[model samples]
Target: MQIEPFTLHVPQTQIDDLHRRIDMTRWAEQETVDDWSQGTPLAALRELVRYWREEYDWRRCEAWLNATGQFTARIDGLSIHFLHVRSRHENATPLVLTHGWPGSILEFRNCIAALTDPEAHGGTAEDAFHVVIPALPGFGFSGKPTQAGWGVERIGRAWGELMRGLGYARWFAQGGDWGSAVTTAIALQKVEGCAGIHLNMPIARPQPEDLAAPSPTEVRALTALQHYQDWDSGYSKQQQTRPQTVGYGLVDSPVGQAGWIYEKMWAWTDNAGRAEDALDRDAILDNIMLYWLPAAGASSARLYWESFGSFAAKDIDLPVAVSAFPKEILPTPRKWAERHYRKLVHWGDMEKGGHFAAWEQPEAFVRELRIAFGKMR
Candidate 1:
């Protein structure tokens, strides 16, 4: 594995072009219902885009990426971008953190310091981790797959190779969203160096009997699943089936790209009416910028096309930990998770947070990982 330092510096012209696109966007009529039923509301989107063009600072984000130890390595002939932040504390555990859709490595930015330097972040040095945060192929600066076959299983193997290449003989993994699927793949592959895995979004399906004799937790989980299948899964369906078709707009229009992602920020976060309740306005745009600047709209979406149905229950015998946020897309019950993760080590039902756990509540996310991985260690 040949690795090299990578720095991010989006050209000023590109920033200007993004602003130009926002200015030229053809406005859509306000939704008939005043709610987010039709899509990202026109007034709300206008306000966000106005701030994005007039006030947001892309250079701050660029500087952070560069200072954060950005690096790239070619794995299986595809360039993979990652942040490698090693803890100065001796014997710090090697931990690879992966992010999912609508999330880039940026999702874990605020967590890096607390994770790699726990002593300074209200924890003993014993909780320290040497963090490796990788952008999934085609999602950030990572090279897009020129052909098919870059699904969860393949990505899992790549992560294993990446860890070994970084000289980590024993490491733990943590993830949510697509990251969870990839982490599960790593555990299932029995990757030699992988010590244990933690998932925020544990994908354990309900059995016939479990549904027939439902517990309160089971009922809530099943209800959320139904809601996802009914109203909230349109993006998944579009990406899974016709990524290229939708990419035209997402790639061409910055507003289109922002709205596509903003809706998820609103729907998935533990917010009170608006996404801004849970997330910073600029942080949201910073994430969207990753997709827009790299023009990764279609390439990133192709991950769904590649691994849509791969979120099934797995009989993983490796030590596992799970944090079930109350607002998670489908907060699987511990009983169901235990059925899949035979050696379940930790199960936490969080009081707050949603799909993007780390981004929504970095402190809680960090605490969960500290406690969960501590059990494995």
Candidate 2:
């Protein structure tokens, strides 16, 4: 496999065009309700748009990514973009962190330094990790898959190969959302050199037998799942059934793309009132740009159409750790997770955090990872 160094330098003309679009946006009418039940309110989006056009700096984000170190490797005929940050500690373990839908490698940016240099971030050398954060195929800087079959299973296999290709004989994997599904697949397939896995959003569902005598946690989990399926799953449904249709609006309209993802950042995060409470305004916009600038709205959504239904909590006999964030779209209980992860090693219930664990709560995210993987080490 050939890996080439990559840097992000969006053309000046494109940046100018984005600003022009934001300036000329045909405004939508304000919502009747002051809350987010309908969707991203026009008032909030207007404020975000104003800030985005006048203040948010893409160069800052680009520079940060460049400084972090990035490369693109052709794996299985597709170019894969990833961040490779090696710890100075010689005994650091190799670990791959995967991002989910509506997220990119940017999600892990804040945690990288802390994770790779634990001694500098209030930890001993034992907690250090050689981190590899990859952009899922058809998202961010990675090449889009032109054909079908690039599902979680294939991506898992590719990750396994990626680790070996990078000269790591053994490595650990961690992820949330779609990334969780991919990580589960990696463990299920017994991917080469996969020592263990950790998940923030595990796909553990109660079996009929288990549900027959539901505990309080199981009941709460089932209720939450039902609520998600009823209200919060419109995006998933559209992405699963007709991604191209939704992508047309998302790719052509910058505001459309921003609204699509921004709503999720708000709805999913453990915020006091606004999404900005949990995440920085600049950070939210930065993540949206990863989709907008790359025009990845279609390709990214297609991953769901390809693999959403195929994901489940299959039994795996490997060291598994889970951090069950309370505000996740669907929080799995410890008992539910233990059913599928036969050799469960670590299980933590985080007080705060949501779907974007690494981005929303980096300190907690890093702490969970170090503690969880500590058992494996």
Q: Provide the lowest-lDDT 10-residue window in model 1.
A: 330-339
Candidate 2 per-residue lDDT, tens place, 97-158, comes to 99999999889989999999998898889999999999999999899999998999999999
Give candidate 2 regions above 4 Å deviation.
none
Tens-place lDDT digits, model 1, residues 71-97? 999999999999999999869999999
Question: Global lDDT of each model?
Answer: 0.94, 0.92
For residue 251, model 2's alpha carbon misses the true position, in angstroms, by 0.7
Per-prediction TM-score: 0.99, 0.98
TM-score of 2: 0.98
Which segments of candidate 1 are over 4 A away from where they belong?
Answer: none
